[model samples]
Target: MATPAAYDGLISHAGSLFWIQSGEGPDQLVTWTASDGVSLAAPQGFELGNEIHAYGGGAVTASASGVWGVSSKDGRIYRLTSDKAEPLTGHTGDQLGDLVVRGETVLALREGTNGDQLVDVDTSTGHVRVLLQSSSFLSSPRPGPGYVAWLSWDADHMPWDSTQLWVARYDDRSGGSLGTALLVAGGHSESVLEPQWGPDGSLYFMSDRTGWLNLYRWDGERTYAVAPMAADCAAAPWELGYRSYTPLENRKIAMRARRDLEDHLLLVDESGHSETFQLPFTAIKPYLCTIDNAVAMIAATPTTAPAVVLVERDGSYAVIAGQEPSQDEVRQPERHSADGIDFLLHPPIDAETTWRAPVIVRAHPGPTDEISLRRDPQLDFFTRHGFAVADVDYRGSTGHGRAFRSSLYGNWGSYDVEDCAAVARHLITLGITLAGEVFICGSSAGGYTALRAATTTGPFRAASARSPIIDPKRWEASVPRFQRAHATALATGATAVSSAAIECPVLLVHGLHDPITSAQDTAALASDLKTRGADHELLMLDTSSHTLAAPDLAAQVLDAELRFFRRMLDQSESAKRT
Candidate 1:
């Protein structure tokens, strides 16, 4: 019963509904009662989490003059009302986030050091007002009824590799300002996203011009696509109100796409007709919220785990909050077709196993991210311990489009270390496991693709990596000068594989306040694998970060990575009986 902390801002107002449960501590803000669920902020030293573009979503939003969020200890912009939450932007170093509110003003998305604009605060004198600056990165500002749409993108694109969708004109006669924005769709090589205004004001978005990521509608001068399909109704904005579609009730829409990696739920209608709806989820979160024809969403189901649901147009859905993962602790993955590689295998929850189980694989940390058949209790704790997970959606991932997500752009650590050694040689050519029992884990660009798959592979008999990036040229000197040109276009020309070309046993784990991969780059690659003697073993957690969000330091870093993969599979079965 202790597994509920995976729900995000699922808004809806006037009918009363809100979400955000940042798991366990700080970043709560619940609210929904017909049987229970309240919280509304503060239950452990304030935090609503929103670091803006450092992977912070449209942290909390709801209107009628209440609930606005973004605090995670001073990135500013609060306003909870009735239950008291305060601080409406004093600009404590200006970070703010993708909020919206309007009608007392909120608009947000600031980020500082002179980049990312579209301001507006002032819910009563917290005064801010920039309204729109040239973008290098800005995001969904979305105001309506006089115009104020948003989303920019440059610095060589990565809001799914391209974005634009402007549209200004929001005046409020002098005290608001925002007029010359224009550029409707997106720049060439499409990738627009979530603009939204509808109910006759017409604008709605999510593009990817024919290469997937569908749904469109403009009406200020004609655009209309509404539902195209190849799959991928949005994702890869990496933050900011990531909704795949919304705008129901008589104009009907409620989307959510993605293909081979699951997630369905369509419902178009308004004369365009679209239907797909066989519920039991497969990962559906991109903020839907609507309440009148009922929509709301937070879904999940590879054996269920995330829940906030609501849906109703006769598809009948309810959950309203989380919890649902017991079918003997659910495992369900099976989808390994190979070819250009797209994974998800999970076998071994206890299939009368006598041996042959040690598998792992994993690798997902946005080397441009992707891997969502949802409910991952750390890949079900490696198939309930007997181990057999695979989960890689490699080749730059992201619901597979944009030429398989630009094939890992400058080849991030060589196409995610050859898609984790082609899913460990298609899971040992389908016999499922063998070849030194396979292993390879990842964290943070999949810990630099599990230390670049232990230096160009031996089909991994040992490798764990969290917080890795041992040295993509010294990790592009800690990127963030507006993402050092996307970390120099994903580590320009790749090739850095070292740790002395690892031959086996390596564990590494890091998190001494990982502000984006740096526990001294896993203590200088465990001090150069202890000056070349190699056979690694680092650890170091001192109160984890880089999303290890503490659940007893993520079960002591998964019990020190299942005791370093069972002492490297018992020293490879004691070197095969000597």
Candidate 2:
């Protein structure tokens, strides 16, 4: 069976809803209505994915007339009608995304060589005009009645590290005029995200000032924290157009909260009283918006694949679109009872096996991101083949509080490597797997962790890293200007663990066109391994990017890695018998 496709960019229009269906081919804009079940708004090969923040989201927005989106083939915005798509903005070198339509003008965030800024485009004339500029990054341009609000930050801080919320008087409908942007909230150590205009004309946003991302509102005077909780109501601003919370009618709010890697849907009343609803889902995408009395989001559980679901205020939900996983395809992972860290242990699917199953400890990408309790087809492939798996939530991962996530500050490789080793040792002590059969694998940041783990005294027989960061010092040059400090902090006290110390065989996979992590780093590491006479192999993909959006390439890489693992395990077992 093929892996399920994911959905995002949920937007509610005039009695109709639309979203972007990704993962299969080029992302297609899908529209749904009560009259028609579902239909494609854009033609085939008209992809909506963009590269604004590297992992772009919110690339599509709906106006009264039609839908406007950033074309994946080009960075220009297009007005996608039912028949054909027409360009709304002329081509510039700047990457445009996070589109929001306001009357006859469409506002978008443009990332250029100068910096990131907000620009307005005429729907008819396709004329682009700069609205705001002189910021390292800008996002979430929410246009209200007579004003527009947005979030901005400098080169010294990431969006999640520190951001400033601003509001300005914008009157583009009457000859296009914009006022001086005034600071609303943020600019401290707190990270603010998703500045949106509420139904009551107030500006509502999420802030992490109290160590947790909670909801707050600005009533044109003072900002008030509404329904404050110890859980994170917002995800890291990795992309644009993520909405963790949305305002409902009658001063109520519908939000999603993250605690211990599990997602909970919440309804908060005006008095700060919250009602948590129990659902089978463990992870819910932040692409959420309220429609009438119900809320729509893409949600997924450990056993169930992601689906676009419309949940009512009464805790009842219906699947709008997307596939659900079958019972045989789902595998539940048990939480490990570690002392202080969080880890999940997934057993082999075949309980009738007599031999101890080989274990693969996973280190998820975005050393800052955590592995959610959602159904992953790749991990399930290992389990179905009689191999156990452990997903480690190393230090610096989200879903925990800020302190836990900030623990890896200036200590990236050390903390993550130690955490993976600890989990592996714990599994071995419990007799879940033998020493020679344990393996470690990861992608991107996790790839760095897996490579570092092989240098430690861990019980890992082999390591596989996809698009891994081999040298932290070399990685600093390729990151964004705002993330240089983070890269420096990660490389400061980091020691270059030699491949000679790693006795286990290694498999390295990388995409030649990866913009985030350079392919040269992987090639250099492979060279070092070869010079040191270390057992290693490198696979290079020509057309794949950092995320490997192509399904065929991803499947091929997975099959290659699995085959490498089986070969290494067989060799180790043969050596033991000899």
Candidate 3:
């Protein structure tokens, strides 16, 4: 079966629901209503995306006038209507993202080589005005009655590492400008995200002041926690326009609280009283908004695909978009913990013959990214091929609070490598996997972990890394300006891998156009492997980027890894017979 279409940036305006759907072609703006079901917000061929902060989001916003979107082809905002699309922002070198409608103006973050600025675009005349400018990067420009609030941070820090929320009086009467501002929250040690305006006029946001991202509100003069739960109410701001919660009527807040890598729907109040609802979906995407007295969001489960879901007051939810796979097509995992690391262990689909089956230990990318209970097609493919898959959510993963997320700060290579090795050893002790049949694989940061583990005295029989970072110091120097410091921080004590130390079979697949990780460095490592006569293969793709945009190429890479593992297993058996 084909992978399901992806949905994101869910929002509601004037009783109509709007979101972005991808995986079919270009990311298209979709609108759904009770009467009309689901339809495209803009005509086909008019794609929507943004490049602000390098990873763009919050590209579409709707007002009474019409819908507005940022063009992925060109860095410009387009007013998307049913009949035609028009450019609202001028064709400049600047890129605008995180579009939010306030009054007659659309507030967005204008990113340029100079710096980032908060700009306002007039919906009526398509005129643009600069509201606020900062040397630091800016995002989530939330405009209230007479004030504008947004997130700002220095180049040395990622948004999740450190951020500041500032609010200033904005006047768009003549040409937009900002007055004296007040620092609402966030500092060097504290990370804040998703500042939004409530119906009560209070500014709401998520802060990790108490070691977890919880709901907090600023009533102009004072700031307090709306919900003081231990669960995190937000994820890292990898993209803009991610709303973790929505303010509802009667002082109620519908929040997607993440705990243990799973998202739970919670209804919280100002008094800190909260109620949890049982839902079919275990994973919920950002940008939750109110619709007809209920909450609407993009959510998924192990048996279902990510869809635009309208969750009602009674806890019943209806999928407005996307489809669900058959029960036989997906398999759930058993939660396993080793050395404080959480991992999902999926036995082979044909469990009856998995007694001596080989195990695939997989590491998720981001190093900060977590593995949820959502259905993944790759896992299905591996399990179907009589392989037990273990998805490790090692230290530094999200959903466990800030302290755990920051645990890998100075020990990126060490912590991730040890944690992945620990999971494999634990499986061996449990008799779930054999020592010589266990393999580790990952991409990007996770790939770094796999390479490091393979060099160590671990149980990993072989290793596969796709576009892996072999040299942290080199990777830190070549990454984007916004993430340069982040890379340096992650590479604090990381050492470059030695090709001579890798004894087992290795498979390396890299895209030539990967901007984050250097393909040249990967090529250099491949040369070293060849000089040492190590059993390895390096597959290079000319058309793909960091993320393989082509589905067939991704499948080809997966099949290549499977073949590499099977060939190694056969070699081991032959050696034993000899």
Task: Candidate 1: give the clashing pairs.
Answer: 243-286, 366-369, 443-447
How do the residues 230-273 of candidate 2 rate in per-residue lDDT, one tens digit apiece?
Answer: 88888777878988987888988899898776889999876789
Q: Candidate 2 vs. truth: CA RMSD?
A: 1.9
Better of 1 and 2 by lDDT: 2
Task: Return the lDDT, model 1, position 380.
Answer: 75
Candidate 2 stretches greater than 4 Å from native: 324-326, 352-356, 481-485
Model 1 agreement with the true structure over 385-440: per-residue lDDT tens digits: 88888888888788877788876768888777777787798778767788888988
Least lDDT summed over 10 consecutive residues: which range in candidate 3? 323-332
Model 3 error, position 85 (Å): 1.4
- Can you give the TM-score per candidate against the true fold? 0.35, 0.96, 0.97
lDDT of each: 0.77, 0.82, 0.85
Better of 2 and 3 by TM-score: 3
In the range 388-475, model 3's lDDT, one tens digit per residue, is 9889988888888888888898898888888888999999998887879899999998888888887888898999998899999988
lDDT accuracy of residue 400 in candidate 3: 86
